[model samples]
Target: MGSLLLLTRIGGRPAAFRAEDIGSIVELTEIAPVPRAPDFVAGLTGLRSRALTVIDSRKALALPGTPDPPDVRAPVVEVGGHAYALLVDRVDDVVAAEGEPTPPPATLGPAWARVACGMIETAAGPAVLIDVAALVAGPHRAAA
Candidate 1:
């Protein structure tokens, strides 16, 4: 069976999320800063009538520095019954995931490896498959 994947760019690096994991792709226009929140937490935004907490994809991937202004888009996903908006550099395209899943590269380092399910080859190239649940669980778990 073929699986669909949503391709995205986080900190300029290629990444993919299972299509089923994404709730919606939205353009982030306003983000209200949450004080005392983790660095990886970008801020919060409203999606429909619900509040969406935005996570900085760059930071979540262990990339350096603060991301620039909210000029890009985000993918809204649910984790632990709560909604999160993933702030990415850009949203690429959705493609069919083909072939067997390969282990994440050792070069991804421990931090990234923990959140990535595996790697898959695509028309664009190999992309790190992000495990949204794991990614979202990281911060909340750490806080406890």
Candidate 2:
């Protein structure tokens, strides 16, 4: 079943993470840091017994790195068989795709844009339909 995505602001920019990817929205807790990982990797948190990685989705998108505003929250999403919190300013309403998924844009630059399957129009405008799995856990990261 094709469901809607909940919009949110990632570092002042608008973005959306599919509701389906989200296991649940949770309150912030103790997020411990891990060593020798990507800067985009926010850290890890314990959910019951499982350790979930928290990613600054904004940072991951190659946006300017800004210290996460404390007020911002995250959705624990199951990505690459592991959990990661996509930090967003706020979670907005869920809405359906207005029409068929659009193919990748020819003029779209930037490396990550390739991972975006396409765009889907919504009430506000078009939201990038990200291929989460590919977006995450992709080719091994070169050294930092």
Candidate 3:
């Protein structure tokens, strides 16, 4: 398949998610914190009358420092029937995949490698294709 990638910045590093995996991009104005939820969960926000569990991608990747504040843009996605808005540092352009995603390089760090489906080429450069399911699952998922 000729995949389309939505390039984004997570933890200040270039990343991509398959375009098909996103439901919509949304600008979150409010988020109510969920008690006892994992640290990666940024809380919940309503989207078109539906509630979305916002995930801080940086935290989900086990990156350092505090996550980007709410009122940030996110990509909405449904994983296992649950809706989620993944918080990203920046939402960049969509680009055509030059080829199928390939194995990420050895130099890839544990945090990114944990959720990386593969690396794909784009006009801008090679970006690790993020596995949305694994990302929403949290940073503890076993690396593939």
CA RMSD, predictions in order: 2.4, 3.0, 3.2
What TM-score would you give candidate 2 relative to the actual structure? 0.77
Question: What would the per-residue lDDT of candidate 2 be over residues 89-130, giving only the tens digit for each residue?
Answer: 566667776776677677655644745667767787776766
Q: Report the alpha-carbon TM-score of model 3 versus the true structure.
A: 0.91
Q: 18-129 in candidate 3: lDDT tens per residue?
A: 9999999999889899999989999999998999999988899888875355327789999999999998888989888899889988788888888999999999898889
Model 1: residue 136 alpha-carbon error in angstroms: 1.9
Tens-place lDDT per residue, model 1, 1-144, is 459899987766788999999999988889999999877887999988999998887777677754455436789999989999998877889998887679998998877888889998887888999999877655434443
Model 2, backbone clash pairs (residues 3+ apart or across chains), number: 0
Q: List the candidate 1 regions with Cα displacement exceeding 4 Å.
A: 66-71, 138-144
The prediction achieving the highest TM-score against the true structure is: 3
Give the candidate order by descending lDDT: 3, 1, 2
lDDT at 28 for candidate 2? 66
Better of 2 and 3 by lDDT: 3
Candidate numbers, best TM-score first, in rank order: 3, 1, 2
Give candidate 1's total backbone clashes: 0
TM, every model: 0.89, 0.77, 0.91
